[model samples]
Target: MAVAETQGIEPVDLAAGSEIDEYILDDGVFKGGMSTLRTATNSVDKKVMIKFFVQETSYQRELSSLYSLQKAESRNVISLIDYFEAEEEDEWFPQSVIVLELGTVSLQHWAHGKRPVSEVYLKSILLDILGGLESMYTAGLVHCDLKPGNIMQFTCPGREQGIWKLIDFDCACKYSAI
Candidate 1:
């Protein structure tokens, strides 16, 4: 990842040992964004990944989309395990509580800018993304942002390797309720 001069000091640190918010995440080559604190747990162990926000202006819309996605695409989308409003330790703290998820790594991390992702990996990712999009589509939702960082890789309870999972729905579609 290429990181440049930080205009503002990062308020949080998002690594394995502790949680943080308002930190600079310069990991993605496609985008530089904010890294927030999050926690994840599988059947065996719990881990954390610095959650990045590619779009901060629409955090509310994205968060709402996530709730809807979670209910319908639970099987395919990376789960947002927890979220809550943040309390100001100081008077200047940000108001929104951060969204958390179960998986942190993505397909790009696997491919490392290499295109023509292997047929097997490509097929697996497509299927999982389709499953997630189908659920959203059925709900009249659209995933406006379908890029590398948003698509994470994870091994669910019964799935094998290459079981790609979708995450980061800040640009997800909106559907009328039934």
Candidate 2:
């Protein structure tokens, strides 16, 4: 399938828009320790996952981590699309949104189902994930939160399928050079 296509899944009504204030929030698809993951459709109906932070500090941490990852330029790392902030009526006043490339299912979901993976396939994924971590370390960044839920599995054919992506860098921190 094309990158922009989502099979038969219709674009959700996120009250979506291009700007920060113009965009709308929809129900979260996944909830993490510091953020809730929601689907936001663009003006062109393209779907992107948005990470809404529960606190301003968490947002800052994630934003900084993503910036570091962007500088690392690792193919095994998840890509950052865009980010924005929207006003909230609740205690979380200004909600920070981190836009990202959408993935089908997380490794956590797969593991939860107790699905058996071929040894070769498991090794391939581990190697790819380690490569990403190596790149982060080389760039002086440490991924503090490395788990299945934070890892995205891409099913694209050929080379794309070879490397799974590491995500959820909110807890990632910069370490002093050794």
The most accurate candidate by lDDT is 2
- Write down the lDDT that model 1 would get: 0.56
For residue 105, model 1's alpha carbon misses the true position, in angstroms, by: 2.5
Candidate 2 contains a number of clashing pairs equal to 0
Model 2, C-alpha of 100: deviation from truth (Å): 0.7
> Where does model 2 exceed 4 Å of error?
1-28, 86-93, 113-115, 157-162
Per-residue lDDT tens digits for candidate 1, residues 1-178, read 1122212224343223222333223232222343353343333344433343534545666678777776785577766654544334543334354445446467778778677667986777788878877877765787887887777877566666646677766666675667
TM-scores of the candidates in the order shown? 0.64, 0.75
TM-score, candidate 1, is 0.64
> What lDDT is reached at residue 12 by model 1?
45
CA RMSD of all predictions: 6.9, 7.5
- Candidate 1 regions off by >4 Å? 1-9, 13-45, 50-57, 88-92, 113-121, 175-178
